[model samples]
Target chain A: AAGVIQSPRHLIKEKRETATLKCYPIPRHDTVYWYQQGPGQDPQFLISFYEKMQSDKGSIPDRFSAQQFSDYHSELNMSSLELGDSALYFCASSPMGTRADTQYFGPGTRLTVL
Target chain B: DQQVKQNSPSLSVQEGRISILNCDYTNSMFDYFLWYKKYPAEGPTFLISISSIKDKNEDGRFTVFLNKSAKHLSLHIVPSQPGDSAVYFCAAVTSYGKLTFGQGTILTVHP
Candidate 1:
């Protein structure tokens, strides 16, 4: 079975720069979700999309934006990168039918802002 | 205010023993619960889940028990192996796909 794919497994950026992380969800999955995990902390929900539409939002920062493309893949764009913005970004996807609540996660992208 | 919580930050179990992890939630409306296992530098993998309609669910060596009255859930791993050493997270979700996770508990299975 193909799992979710995330780009740039590891990233290093300087303060005030920008970065974009991409996520290719599992084939046929209709929902994509983004989460952030800081050092020694649990994953926190950032945002989610269903059927290419924004379905819900969490603690995502105003400087960050995300969108799901027609191919069912999603991208998270962050600007004005700060040292505190560094963390592990994860993407998860699930079918929108009866198992919509079950999420399959990607390996995650480690962002280091210095 | 944490909605889901794991009181014990870590636990240790000998190989072939049973390991039990606990989780508590304050939301009564959460109709579904799930458990995930994560290795270092990897994403979380779904291990097991139990809906509010059922009190217990068993999958291979793992079992999940839900106590709606007490707003608690537990995951039990029998015949634990050294490879099972990882961080385990418990999460609850309503029907909307919004999942609230607990601050995971680290379990070490020593051989």
Candidate 2:
């Protein structure tokens, strides 16, 4: 079974710069979710999309934006990157249905803002 | 305020013994509960989940029990092996698929 795919398994950026992270969800999955896990902390929900539409939002920062493309893949855009933004970014996908709640996660992208 | 909490930070079990991890939630609206196992530098792997309608769900060597009235859930791993050592996270979801995770509990099964 194909799992979710994330680009740039590891990233290093400087403060005040910009970065974009991409996620290719499992084939045929309709919903994509983004989460951030800070050092020593649990994963926090950032945002989610269903059918390419923004479905829910969580603690995502105002400087960050995300969208799901027609291909069911999603991208998270961050600007004016801050050192605090450094964390593990994860993407998860699920099919639309009663079992859609069960999300399959991708190996996270480790973002290090220098 | 943390809606989901795993009070224990770590647990140790002898191989072949049973390991139990507990989680508590304050949100009454949460209807679905899930447990995930995570290794360092990797994404969480889904273990088992139990819906509010079901009191218990079992798989292979893992089982999840839900007590709706107590707003508590627990994951049980029987015949624990050293390979099972890792972090376990408890997550809850309402009608929406958005997950609220609990601080993970590290479990070490000694061989």
Candidate 3:
């Protein structure tokens, strides 16, 4: 059972800088979701995509953008990063719409904005 | 506003005892509820889920009881083990794949 794969398990950036986080979902999984969890807080939905199409949106900031590539992989790009953006960024995948968002999560990428 | 709420911030129990966690939701449109366990510095892992149609769902030692009238839900772990120690989050799905999560409750099962 291959789980979701995320790149750069940890990222450190300065305010006003840019960072790109990548995610490779499980095989045959068509839906990808991004969540941000601040310290001692619940995971907050950022955005989601299904089959390279934007399916739903959440509390994602305007400075952040994401896209699911043809390979079913996705990337979250954050520009003009702020210190408040520091949190654990998680990527989750689901097999298909049938599961109705029974997501399997990746280990997550911890972003630290200095 | 937070639709889902987990009032207890933490709980501790001895091994072999039962651990119960409570959750409440304000959204009546939510049709499904899920429980996820997360360790420090790790992503949440799905534990159990129940549909709005059912009042109770059991999986091994884990059981989830839903009370639609009260708009409440609870997760029970029987014969708790130290391995069960972690933070538990309750999530609700109204439609699509979007999930709204509640503040988690940390459970510590001491051996």
Q: For model 3, how does the per-residue alpha-carbon lDDT over A1-114 read when each residue is reduced to its tens digit?
A: 799999999999999999999999999999999999998889999999998999999999999999999999999999999999999999999978455436999999999999
Instruction: For model 3, state the Cα shift of residue A5 in Å.
Output: 0.7
In model 1 chain A, which range of ten residues has the least summed lDDT?
Answer: A94-103
**Cα-lDDT of candidate 3:** 0.94
**DockQ, candidate no. 3:** 0.71
Question: On residues B1-111, what C-alpha lDDT tens digit does candidate 2 reach at each position?
Answer: 899999999999999999999999999999899999999989999998988999999999999999999999999999899999999999999858899999999999999
> What lDDT score goes with residue B78 in model 3?
99
Candidates in descending DockQ order: 2, 3, 1
Compute the interface RMSD for each candidate structure: 1.5, 1.4, 1.4
Tens digit of per-residue lDDT, candidate 3, span B4-82: 9999999999999999999999999999999999998788999999999999999999999999999999999998999
Q: Which prediction has more favorable TM-score, 1 or 3?
A: 3
Deviation from truth (RMSD, Å), model 1:
1.0
Error of 1 at B15 (Å): 0.6
Candidate 3 colliding pairs = none
Query: What order do you get sorting by TM-score, best first?
Result: 3, 2, 1
Candidate 2 C-alpha error for residue A10, in Å: 0.4
Q: What is the lDDT of residue A3 in candidate 3?
A: 92
Task: List candidate 3 segments past 4 Å from native.
Answer: none
